[model samples]
Target: MKHTIKATWMRGGTSKCWVFERSELDVPGFTTDEVLLRLFGSPDPRQIDGVGGGSSTTSKAVILGPSDEPGIDVEYTFAQVGIDQAVVDWGSNCGNCSAVIAPYALKRGWVEPEDGILTVRIRNTNTGQILIERMNLDGSEAEAFIPGVPFPGQAVDIGFLDPAGATTGALFPDGKELSTLSVEDEDPRTRSDITATLIDAGAPVVIIDAQTAGLGTADFRQWPTACTAEMPRLERIRRAGAVAMGLAKTEEDAQRAIPKLAIVAPAESGSDADIKVMMLSMGAPHPALAITGSVALTLGAHHPGTLIAQQLASAPDGELRLQTPAGLITTWQRQIDGQLAVGTSRTARELADATLSFDPAGERTENPAVILAQGTGLDEQQLEPDPPPHGRRTVFASVAAFAVLGLGATLVGGGLLNPPATTADGDYAGETLEVVIPLAEGGGTDTWARFVGQELVHDIPGEPGFAPINDAGGEGITGSNRFASSAADDGTELLVSTATTVVPWVLDRHVVKYSFEDLEPVLVNGTGGVIYARTAAGVKSTRDLIDRKKPLVFGGISATGLDLTTLVAFDLLEADITATFGFEGRGPVNLALQRGEVDIDYSTTSSYHSAVEPIAKEGSATVLMSFGQLDEHGEVVRDPNFPDAPTVVEVYKDLHGKEPSGPKLEAYKTLLGLTYTYQKGLWAPKDAPEEAVDLLRDSAHELSGDEEFNKKAAEVLGGYPIVADENLSQRVKDAYTVTDETKGYVTALLKDSYGIELD
Candidate 1:
């Protein structure tokens, strides 16, 4: 008598997997491992008897269910079942497969509302967290289509919360953007350690120039020939990195999984797009990992401390195209004001005739050959006169077959590991530092906080840890509530607090449950912001704009709260300027500007400096004046990048000093100061034991002093540390304070100039 277990084999991207529901499996004889092996026909290269594809990466499984939590809608668990081994890793989440959760939930009856764009909040059971998965449905079925997957299956959009330091404890875990580890052999050489930013975005993998990896970018498709000779050496490096990142308890663990690797360089003519790359999966090379891997690598490439940081391209927030074996994967991400909002795309791959059904046990029952567990016994008397009714009803768990994992990140350091440490105040290290950041990851405040964390890992007295948790909605209210109410004064948990928090606290007053006075400042770090423009506006200079070719459309990062200042500036430029709110960052704004969608934005000078410098030098964009209260040579200096551009005061004078007023302006002023607050320190919560805070803070200070940090900072961030100055932070914060009338004026100016309406 054979026992039957149902399953559905699905293909996502280049990867394939067998998906199941928790209610599947009635076999009492098979243990969890045995059940998995039997269902997938594991431990065989052929897997001829089962749906398992031979490749290790493809031989995977996932279990999905409606979320047990109140607010969330779904739950997901991933299993990397080996083809040659019986082991299935229940730890960690797959960033790629994660894209499928919502579709799966929508197709299955686990979630409620069966119609039109349902948001299925998913809890990633593997990482112990929840993530938002947006599913587009027509009625009781899916409507959105995603690339890579077949049959135009539902397209699911995933959003990560507080991803900074998700894998690693610090955004700059090693303190330096590119640190030189003193290995005992092969010279005291310098290797890039961008684990900081990489960890911040949870892409702790290193990307070497393809040439460094001993291949040209054009040769990625010839990998079958290249891997035989060059892959082994790269594998060694990847394994070493895993150890360095502390993902592996030993070097051997790295040999199995973790610290994914990729090599990139300039793309070949007609080779898909802008840049070309080759990504590695386990030991095998990926035809293409898409922009997901690149997104992870972007942090390493852009932030201080990491090898190959210098090889990255610089462009404002927007579409970054990558050429892979499968063609192009375009990543669309940006900072709205100062927070990161990211997404990616490829031509949608429609899976045709892709349909699945489930058995009464919630297991896929479509493949008749797989029902090997069915049994026929001779009990006679009509099966003992029918067993008692147990009310065990299994409904169809037919979902679109994808999952989402968007949990609020608790800072994990070194890109791996979570451990408690005693702090300087003689308190047990806090369980975990839950940092609520008003902005999204990769924003200025978030970036600064990450840098501080990186520095602390090496310099701070304690191996203290904190992660930036982004709750970017309701202007800054959502994030602020998480911070003001949930985060305690204990030194363990802290807020990588930003200007958005201050803006709402001062202006709306109703934005958060607690006042700004309720929170305590741990330290102040650094400052950087930019006044940028897109390439298409056709206005070569401020004068060209003053000449008025057309209404120059400028964009602000936020839709409400703190964006008032930039909006006000646009108001002053209203002679020819037309502005709007809702560009997440320079990247998207740059894309929009290039596409003639918008014109200018107040981006960070430092953030855009590297990416735009080449373009600017090539005369692509005209940098406007840098705005802040900073004095230069006894007077406010114009931006060096655009010496000809006028100051805010000069522009104001030229446009007439008519002031705008109200809570909006007050909010704008408050938000503008976030750029300067970039220099402020980030720490665990105040309620965190004093000892932990001291250790982390002290270690950070110590690491900040390292010569290596200075070098990486200059190379990656394009600037050296300005060091933390409480007085400077205080002054910067003060600049945001304004009367209600002034706030209203600023708000009106912003609305008038940008057509941005704030409630």
Candidate 2:
């Protein structure tokens, strides 16, 4: 008789696999290997009858159980079940599917939501390290939407709780600045003792200059051809480096996985990604690696002992641009020299994000993705992780859990994980913008806005003038409105805000009465989105969701507006949608999106674009439609970032009899018209002095034009250029031309959907 084991099929990164709870596989005496092989359907090219996707990368399994560790919410064990081979590798970690731990914990009842966001502390079973996966909830509900998955998925915000040298023994694994390892390849021309940076953040990796391999980091597709020609050399270097990094116990072990190889080049090199690092799958390069890896490489490049540090092209103390397979990745780093020891490389990765203001007079900006799944429950605790040999015993979980357990688990134990808290706060302090945001520190918008402030301080016309004050609360409007109302018009105080700034106005949910009209636009920054799903189900594409024949629930930043618009489109398409509103921010909403309880969500394109583009390409999620101004200017300029999908207008015309129109139609048009018209601008009160406003705007504009700023912006925006200007009033007005009917309809629509009756 066939052994029928319960398994959950999940899609992580570009791969798919079956998951089994530890309890489900407790058939005593059968080694873990025996059960895993049975799960993968060994020696079968066609795992046709099984959940395995057949590809080596896809035939994987994960077993999650309850963790009794004082600070951890759950314990996760990942098993890479081999296809056609009888081995199951459990030595390294899968950072991609590693994201699923929190969602899974919620589904199994490992964590309980407190208020807005529930922090699920995950003790990585592989590394015995703690990782905090921020889970957001709508009354004990998980919401989050990540890219590269189908439909809207559960959002589980993953942050390394104490991430230091997760792979290698030290942050800068090698004691020397650059290590020279002999090339084992047949190619005599390749350099012997090649310069490489072996740093351990989340993984052990060897970063080399593409030029060292006699190749350029131009296009990723071209690398396959280059690899084919130099396969022997590439293979040798990868293997040798793995041993040097201690990721491999034997020569053959490195050939399989761990200590992945990455090639970095100058951003001006016109490469596919300014820093093109191969993903987890060794045979086929990943479209892009995980964000954790990026952080790891960045840390390695700055240290003296790594190869990346030796080849360091001197960069100013500002934005550091990393070219990768996907595009340019921008990280705003502030270095603390004394902290650059072998195991302690302290730095901050500065990032930016934006919010939008809408009116019926203009086109609607693109609608970002939001969380759909709302996973429930937590598993019963069972697994325990052994601490790594050298590092401090760190547990990465929630503060509340630690407090309740009466244990002392440092956020970054012994300052080994991230930079010290004191240093982290002042990384960009003392010389900057005048505007201050009154929000919690380390928030997405807060981080980006502060980075922009740093840029202005570093390069703008009025250098050392602009300052950002943190006074964030009440959906980021109170602090922002404070800037709009009181800050000097000379552009000292600029409020960085989002669609919440406007959506609430239409809904009258915000106590502060204001609209896009109250603030003068300075320059639009950037935007990103959330992808969502439920934790219980592993549906990779929109097609999978549609096939399931269930109403895929979605959540919104607010009740109506952009999030609702996407659901309405689904409604028109006869796709099931159940949307909830009034969750703290996109951050929490994203956590819910991943739980499978809520199946869809909308987030900024910038945030989720990198993670999601591959999903669209892989046929997992439906592009549905983007909400942005119809590409005009006499020629249709495709979004180079998402080539397969059409513009919002194109999709609308294709889906319905006509394009999106009416008063709300005008609102949609107007919103899209200003899609990139600086959705979230650094603004002051309309009444602020023209000189102050001009000063701030001009400074911001000048900073935006800085070479470093431009390079980083290009990187973050996925190569699509951002237009940052000082005189946004004209730009805003030019994009704004609405009839009274359009205005009334927009207001009415907001009220009907959000329960707010705005005049």
lDDT of each: 0.51, 0.51
lDDT of 1 by residue, 373-427 (tens): 2222211111121111111111100011000111223656644244433344543
Kindly give the stretch of ten consecutive residues in candidate 2 with the minimal lDDT sum: 367-376
Model 1 misplaced stretches (Cα beyond 4 Å): 1-434, 438-447, 465-476, 534-536, 547-549, 573-575, 632-635, 638-647, 650-674, 677-706, 715-736, 751-758
Where is model 1 poorest over a 10-residue stretch in terms of lDDT? 395-404
lDDT of 2: 0.51
Among the numbered candidates, top TM-score falls to 1
- Model 1 residue 466 lDDT score: 34
Q: lDDT of candidate 1?
A: 0.51
